[model samples]
Target chain A: MSTRFRPTTLTGHELELREQVRRFVAEEFPAGEYLPGLGINAEASPEFSRKLARQGWLGMVVPAEYGGPGRTAVERFVVVEELLVAGAPISAHWVGDRQTAPALLKFGSEEQKRRFLPAIIGGEAWFCLGMSEPGSGSDLASVRTSAVRTDGGWVLNGQKIWTSGAHYADFVVTLCRTAPLDGVKHAGLSQLIVDLRSPGIEVRPIMMLNGFHHFNEVFFTDVFVPDEMVLGAVGDGWHQVTSELAYERSGPDRFLTSFPLLRIFLALRARRAVGAEAEHRIGRLVARYWVLRQMSLSVARSLDAGEVPAVEAALVKDMGTTFEQQVVDVVRELADAEQRPGGDLFDRLLAEATITTPTFTLRGGTNEVLRQVAAKSLLRGAGRAA
Target chain B: MSEEIELLEQTLDALFARHCGPAERTAAAQGLLPERLWARLVETGLTDLGAPDSGAGLPELVAVAMAVGRAAAPVPLAEASGLASWLLGATGLDPADGLLGCATTHPDDDLRLVGGEPAAPVVRGVLTRVPWGAAAGHVVALARSDRGPVVVLLPAATQVERGANLADEPRDTLRYADVTAVAAAPAPVDAAAVLRRGALLRAAATAGAAGRVLELALAYAGAREQFGRPIATFQAVQHHLVVMAEEVAAVDLAVRVAALAGPDTEALAVAAAKVAAGTAAAEVTRRGHQVFGAIGATIEHPLHHYSKRLWSWQDEFGTDRQWSGVIGRAAVGAGADALWPTVSAPLDPAPEAALR
Candidate 1:
């Protein structure tokens, strides 16, 4: 049997990058500055994102010629981890930096790259995904958003639900069916770089459980996306979107959403002499977190080497989001702090985490869907070997 | 792996395949050691691969332990090669040509040194659940001396009452009234350090067994039919198999980190590895049995071999709960501000100074 799953240790450079990111977060986005458990969709300030871009953090994996720092995926992972742990508001530039830039680099035309890459790297543009429609949550292949071919462009008409940050995004990389659905369900679909400010488009707020307006229902009625704005080839939306899921699924964001609460709990627990039970509970959580981090880092390394690692990415997401929710469960069980909505930091963070915990396994492809994806791939591989 | 280690692994694999087959394992499980296989392993220098002079490190020993685990070979690879040889070489004893074992299982075993009167010390008290205590040529154990905790090597001629763990390996109880030591020296590490080493070895073995069980479950799911279709086609069985795979993968990475960790981080790394591996062993074995249904529970099926060993090994060094306590205490002690840094610090490979 091939030893494909051998463990990996970080290099000196990756360690250095991690330390640098940690120091940056501490100095710039200190613990008390922001509320905890804001989730990854917390509204971020453009100024903060620009500051990160100045530090050569944003667009880390994009090539230098495209106005990026040209770092490896592991380096990007270090930055993302530190930001998440610090509870930094990264939503402003998250989608554009994390997935949009990479997608543009891979499948975008030269004009599209020249037009969008620099703005994304400069933290001036925010991108929200337009994949999930009103009727197509996990069944993304059934997306009914149509893009009828016009003289100079495609007229988009459909409704996209759960579009995170659509209100603040400058553009949405909308997935639409461009041709008749007479062939394979995945074919004849295309990705269009639809400008969010175009005519005949409306963004309606969908408040979260915490009364946060981070999610939206975006409607596109005859929104004209020019041919120059198309991402990749027409009729290749399925492949392009699936390729981007690796980035969406294998990030530190999936697991670090509730990390701020954990940090507060640990700090509070340290002041008092908690008994062995608390210690054991805290320790198990930390150990599990460490394992998850290592596993996520391994996926990053694979991505750095330009391997898709779709199954591995799905595995990380499935395990990671569950661990993220577990962090909330553990803190709630152990913390003696009050659970009032507007009490001390511990209570407030605990409340936020309680509200946000349910979404951890729901977003970025529900855990059930991801498990099926991973299972099929793994069984197929095993069957071939057998 | 280095060229030499890879060659050694290939050699060991070939050796196990030739001599340590199902019949041999069954015999070993029936209260008998495969003497010929053990002799071959020792003579081939595979058992002493962890000696300082052997130019192999813990990573190499981990590889050997994993191989030993995959075959369920009834040898003291972990105890002898991993812990004993390192201890012997550290305390200035000859590590050559001895099947060594250690008695450091329980914390309350009151083994102490007495009466050598300016010469070597004599060991007393009882050490329970000592791995390979009856079969080993010598046993290295921690005993309280007038100075402090000293390590004493006792010959296997001491009185030993044979015991067995879940997997039927020799976990004997040794009673030493006045067993004279062949060699006595200061312990290179504390009892906790010794336990961590043993835990690391067991984690590696567990990972190997977990990997094997995952392969078994996968193959079985593909073949077994339910409702006139392969059970593997069902989402439920596939989910179980994937979870098993995830556990195996986590254990594999955790073991590597623990094995290669520096002295400063070794304790935390090992504790994490043990917890993850122990937990994984339980889940993987349970799911493996679930996938195989009743056949996996029967002794006739080979699946029970790996699953039983996993069940026994998870509790041998330290259960998940026990190690979780160790890790939890350490993290809480470090406090919130320092926890991330403490866990994410780059590993130092420097050997630790002798434990105080």
Candidate 2:
């Protein structure tokens, strides 16, 4: 009955953009330039981010008036999907390009956008999220981070953990409580763009299981965020952060994180006479990947059309991350390459993917949390129908 | 959808509601032909929607097939209107006047066209699992001839042992001893192509059935109470319903995109869609039953009407294993370097346009 589920066909311009992005990746990410499966954050390269900025790939959805390409969501999806499948080093500008820019465009004051948008598009300003604190990972509304109103700014005192790229980021859009909790836990929360280089702020690297220093435990001791840096409105952090999560959850990165490894596994299988069972298994994975891409593209199209398909975006992330993890498992089974340290390319990539597989569903909102979001949306729909 | 399609959908909805109710469907499942309903359907020109060489676009056929599936109509509308008519048209034969069915076997199946050359081929051996074989007046099938794959129209008057699938729809096995063809023509496409078409139709039907099951599950979840509250309020039940909804959504998109793909990519698209639909059908039906609890499992409930059809249709043209194998081989054969290109190729409008 609802046309929301209808499949979308790529327009000629979108197809052309896909080819251009593919060519850009091919030329830029020549084999061996970047290792696969390092996860998005661990693969940071400032130089590569600048190259994308030069090519107008970053901030694609930002309006041209703010020094962006002013592209549609589908066009942005084409570029991001190509970058992701190639396992390009997109971490340096990933957060700012993906969600921060979009959030700023949506809810930022003109002065804030003029100050932040150009730098973000130019790859000079990198952003890391601060929604999750020491105890509030999935339960974001229960964040204890406080920003006390002061003379000309807010004195921020909080700790944000699992903050990817915070050490390299120029700013952290921290979610802080501006007022004491009333009847509602979600109320009184505000988003303040904290300068990472500001006084009294400390960034400590948190090493991953593979010893990758992509995450940071950021602590703020009376750090000041000027009143001009507040995003959207005061007490609107819950809504603004949730909207940003939609952008974060529905991107090509969710599923394509392990695709490079899949491509390698497929290449390995192609070299030999694979058994029928192996072929079926690989084919099943490819089919699932293809369908997920289509679904994700549809969500992108919806976003471009100015619809907030939060539930649809959640579905994509839940299914896409699950598929991403499965790709790792399936590739491990298909290829006999040992995931050893400093081994062959196949072995190394597999090892990285194996270690990173645990985070595919954990990051960007755990799959369980996303499923609850989707289920609640469905129940709401059912209620509406009844 | 255009106003015409929307109006057509409403008309079909009313027609099914009036004639294809629970009792009528039950009686039809028991081998009684609803002659009046069949005549009414034929009078509506629904049977000729996929007439031989009609050059019908897949979207139109998919619309009709989905309606038939949603109604769980016991008639072989998909076989007659979608597959059989398209096959007949492919071979340049006039469309059959009445109900028509089709069969495409695995390469290892025993069915073959042994004699009489290409112009006048003769079918031999037994054709198994022919949809509506006992009920149809004519059957169009893809069989291996001396030259290659050929399309043959066999009259249903030949000896046949009637059978039924999980949905209790006819899946009769036909025993042919050099049965002469009423009309035979060289197939423009290979057996695999025909099989893919059938699989596409099945995927569309499965999507339709899956959609209905989601609706039913949601409605039931909203009404049925447990622990002093509606089950829909329960997180576990809500989760199951969401999973079903996601599967339905995926299957629906897969079928539509596959239908719109070009010929070069149609096989891969159809194969992918079939795998998605077949896999989703299993999960959606399982969850649908879970949501309805004991009532959904009982024969008296109409839920089985859709669930059983989904289960049967998923494995009819090809199971998940079969279609996934097709897709896998294609991907592997293309190798990794060419994988993205193979997937991202621009799709031609619709197959019927090129055929025309």
Point to the candidate with the largest DockQ: 2
Query: How do the residues A305-339 of candidate 2 rate in per-residue lDDT, one tens digit apiece?
Result: 67887887788888888888898788888776556
Q: Candidate 2 residues B1-356, lDDT tens each?
A: 44565676678778888989766676678765667778888898777677644456777787777788778877777767777777787677876656777875644346578787576677887778777777778888777767777788887747888888888887778877888888888888777777787888888888888888887887888788888998887878877887887788788888877877876778778898999988788889889999999988998898999999998988878888988888778888878887776655546653332121
- Best-matching candidate per TM-score: 1
The positional error of residue B235 in candidate 2, measured at the CA in angstroms, is 3.0
lDDT of 1 by residue, A1-386 (tens): 21233345567777778878878887886666557435585666788899998888888888878777888887888888888877888889988988899999999999988889889888889999998987899999899999998999898999999998999899998888999898689999999998999999999999998988889999998888898998999999999999987788878887778888888877655553278888778878878877777777777877777788787778778888888888888888787655788877778788888887888899877888788888788778888988
Q: Model 1 residue B6 lDDT?
A: 76
Interface root mean square deviation per prediction: 5.5, 4.0
- State candidate 1's TM-score: 0.95
DockQ, prediction 2: 0.50
Chain A only TM-scores, each candidate in turn: 0.96, 0.96
